[model samples]
Target: MFHIKRAYEAYIDGFQEITMIIPKSNKHTVHSYFELIYEDNRKTKLPIVTRIEFERFIKYTVFTPEDLSLENKYEIEDEFGVRTDLQVGGVIRSNDFDEKYAYDGEDLGASYSNHSTQFKLWAPTASKVKLRIYQSHGDEEKFTEKLMERDGKGTWKVIIDQNCDGLVYNYLVCVNLIWREAVDPYAKAVTLNGKNGVVIDLSKGSHVSKVNSPLQSKYTDCIIYEASIRDFTSHPLSGVHKKGSFEGFHEKGTTYNELSTGLDYLCQLGVTHIELLPFFDFEGIEENNPFQSYNWGYNPLNFNAPEGSYSLKPEEPMTRITELKKLISVYHEHGLRIIMDVVYNHVYELQTSNFEKIVPGYYFRQDERGLPSNGTGVGNDFASERLMARRFILQSLKYWTEEYDIDGFRFDLMGILDTDTMNQIVTELTILKPEMIIFGEGWDLNTSLSPSSRKATINQSHQLSKIGFFNDKFRDGIKGSTFSVQEIGFIQGKLNHDYLSDLLLGSVGINNQVSLFQEPYQSINYVESHDNHTMWDRLKLSNGKDSEELLKKRHILGTSIALFSFGVPFIHSGQEFFRTKEGIENSYNSGDTVNSIDWARAERESSYINIVKEFIAIRKRFNCLRFSLKEEIVRHIKSVKVHQNIIGYRISGIEEIDRVKEIMVLFHNGLKDTTIDLGNEDNWEYVWDGTKHYVEKGIKAECNKLPIPLLSTVVLVKY
Candidate 1:
């Protein structure tokens, strides 16, 4: 009489090595001989000669089962009275075994056509799988259930002869005799609140792909504006009929206080890219009262489907798809590229997610003791190293790019992902759309990956050659730390000449002998984004109850440095008008009071907005600001430290086709105004003075004795 504990078989060069974990309780009585029964009912006795003893169990390996096939369903019996059936997936985690051989199925979700619908699920360890179909999302009464058959690939599949369009479904999987119900991981659309996966024809035509955006030769040419779909138009004064909806984001010509609002305002701002924070299906926020709840859309529920809360009809599967497509088309038609801020790092709930429920422990990284890894600090980090996990991410990216015609992607917590996935994404997407802007927040997070593995962090940016990262060094060097309200940066009178020079050169290789990137385009220079306090609030808190005038000047100075810096420039939606969340550091889920843009405030701060708009025009007018190559940057740019509080730079080597031959930029962080002597004899035209700007013959170009206002940045051009 023999009993079995854990049995697995590994194949190497047509030879099978069966390993078994036998409990220490039966060690003395257990026999070294084992018998294997194949599907043909033929039994063969083998000797388990080698044994590695552990405190709780004994590991035994036998090399006699050389001709056993991986697909053969077999049984094992040992002399210690242990007996059990064998499974191919049981040995996938054995030491030195290739885990890549773990069985996977590509068509593991419902696939529908006009004539028939087929459903498949990859559950190697499960004894049974069933499909349940309902007429609609809410109609659960007397729904139909169909049995599925297991295939050679370990996938359970079924095909319904009739068309199953306009139906909602879920799977009833029986794992080890315990039944569990789950939604499809590859669902293209979901019902309200993500209750079930919906089946519908995705062939509905839209004009999203036909719209074109203004092209630039380099990634540095893009100036990104980040906004949330709900917060963008949730205010009552937003002047759009469909407030807090996708339609509102697409609405044009709306105004508040006689100033253009919504899409019209963005067009007026002259931004080249609009980065929307997480438009995917996210948890939380009741769809009934969308305005009552507010979120930055970081909690992702489904990677491929749009959020129902932002759609006109939350119940209909095709509603969100059509509306979001319309919104993208509208932005492209206005010559604006849309960048989606994707959050694939973690999920809202781990156990309930489709990825987890569909495949038990395959999608996430786990420790040796089988505990989930918390590298993202959000409980569970996705395991991009796994083949299926990598494939899922790559497939989702392709679907978005080809279906929606999106211009770019901003990955959230990108450092948690392995470098191989990021590089693979860039390689694949470039083939689809050349010159697409790709960047993200590559903060070094605690992850399971080793330090040398592919990471998208600032220190490891060279590994991801084409991807850009939000330059925290440039952010803190220009404005202040994102975490603290008391720490003041350069604009608040804490100037570091060496650091400023590095940031101005895009933090590229060796401008100040300390660089965070290999190329200028790899740095996204910004002082304010959606994650932290606005520049206005930072100055107010750190500068200590400062006067409004002084705060305004400091804010302008910070913006000037960011816009003028090398690499891509990113701005928050209302940063131009000094948007504030009432000193709240993390306003991700706060309601409209703290999250809305307050178009009224933007109206009052129109002067500052005008300055920012002018700065963008100036940045675009000069080719020196958008240099793409490292050699060009080193040769064309020069910086000098005039004083502890003053720094100046001269940018030359502009192409003959450019409007100006050379430009001088000066930054003064002192409390009082200062004048500097220009080394050159050529007359310098004052193109910008922080508060004012001139286009032609700006204030009579003077090479010597140039005055810069207190806490100001100036740009002078010379032909």
Candidate 2:
């Protein structure tokens, strides 16, 4: 019923003999000679043509090369005398160009010198490329355009021997005679909202804080606190000098209700690393007045550049970079590490995105119908398996670690990425910093890539040995399903307490046939994260009839289990004080009021905060809480059959214990108090009890029977 209106393609196989392919659908329609027109107004007639079958709907007619030499303008006339501009479509595949014309240039983006600046772009198929440089901002009248030369490696390069420092620039790439402007993908600095790439000497950003991140030997040793920069100080009571900026994180002595806020508050809480939500240059927030807009920064605009919206001076790109460095520096000075939340799985826009604008259909994955793939639940999943895409990701990670000195990375929707790319990242990053923590949401998403191809899910966790996954099993097991509020977890009267034993052993063991991780370090155990409802809200929704006392008990019980687990423990910011999003489940764009931490509640509920602090101290004080190897876990840690609702475990063979030769961690989830029978009841001593309103010293046990109050986690030690 349909016929090809017009088709044009050029075959380039060393240029010795070039052919133009005009594919027609419904070949049953007439026939005629194909004409070729050159830029010099010369016409070449192709009297002879060969027909070939190309696709189901298309029939290709090939025309011999007309000996046209380096011509930019070309038009192909079909049998119906309809002339169309020739484009390089089926003439080449994205991967073919990637493999054949891979850019071997040592420097990417804008590499600068005192007298000259070289700009490079990897657009192998671009017919013609030009570099447009502006004299200054708000001055469109004065600018210069320079023609670029293409190398065999497919890189387009233009050198400006004059000083182009502080000048804004963009690339003008032509495809099928259609020109498109694109921001540099390798740009280290960009204008507000990524309008253009700025030519600034990166070396000028030399002034940096001397502070270093807190040292961590292993991933399990970290107690991570997840936070959003905007939400941290956007609260009206935050009292920070700079509200909703990287500078706000450095604000000292800022407090509410006589309690410390910002970095000072985190110090008091004693978390080793602060995993910040994405701060990379992302779309959505207007840079000029960023406080008016709030985002979690998952919509990545520029992977390597720091977000301008988070900087005090959004106009200056270096400030965004320098300010973020200073913020990390301040955290480092206070013995804290910063973990960057990276979103490389998908981009916000398709056509408008630089990945598309520069290389068209090359950067993204295509489905069976050749449409953009949406595995991340975001519109387009990045084709990380592609050569250039993988290279970009690897380079971006290195930039963040080396430039900003980030101690860790939290990849969002990491399962959308292929295992090969993830393993390569681990291999390279491990060499750079072996101690650097790398973890992410390894959720299995149905992507264009089949299950066996790319998924970095928990089932495939063995492949990525060094990387870790956010233990959704631990998350759901401890605080119920994040999806439904009515669904209760282990702490909230969910009967099957047997699964808690699996989690207590870090969700993996030699005996555990149904383990989620190959090693304990691969599991990032947590009850609440930035993605879903807070533990308080989940408990509130699930247990509506439960009193405030029971709700608080449930909250503490969840934290206790996660903290005691043999994995890298993670907590959402303000989770210690029963943080509530006012029942808003997904607060990604719910504005400041909906997402800001309630410091007043923190002060009122200081006891619960004290409970979290005490747990952190205990985890730090005892080597038993953090087992180094899987063999040690199996040999030393074992589950005890205390009760159906009680999850109990014992710690032995720990040489670092000064007072306790045997340690027992027991959790009582039942509505009534439960009695635990310690095998060595006579020698057992009650070292710590969660039922106490405040943290206190060890109290001597009665020795016959250990009575644990309902909804409380108790610890006992025997010397």
Task: Write the residue-wise lDDT of candidate 1 on 322-423 in tens digits.
Answer: 899899998988999899999878888788777776556667777655688887877898878776677788878888999888899999999988889999
Candidate 2, residue 422: Cα displacement in angstroms equals 1.1
lDDT score, candidate 1: 0.79
> Which of the numbered candidates is closest to the native, going by highest TM-score?
2
Among all windows of 10 consecutive residues in model 2, the one with the lowest summed lDDT is 10-19
Candidate 2: the clashing residue pairs are none
TM-score list, all predictions: 0.90, 0.91
On lDDT, the candidate that comes out on top is 2
Worst 10 residues of 1 by lDDT: 6-15
Residue runs of model 1 more than 4 Å from their true location after superposition: 1-108, 122-127, 149-156, 207-209, 484-487, 655-657, 693-698
Clashes per candidate, residues 3 or more apart or on different chains: 10, 0
Residue 509 miss distance in model 1 (angstroms): 2.6
Please list the Cα RMSD from the true structure of every candidate, rounded to 1 decimal place: 4.0, 4.1
lDDT of 2 by residue, 73-139 (tens): 5676656766676555533334555666666455778888889999988887688889988777646
Error of 2 at 355 (Å): 1.2
For residue 673, model 1's alpha carbon misses the true position, in angstroms, by 1.1
lDDT on C-alpha atoms for all candidate structures: 0.79, 0.79
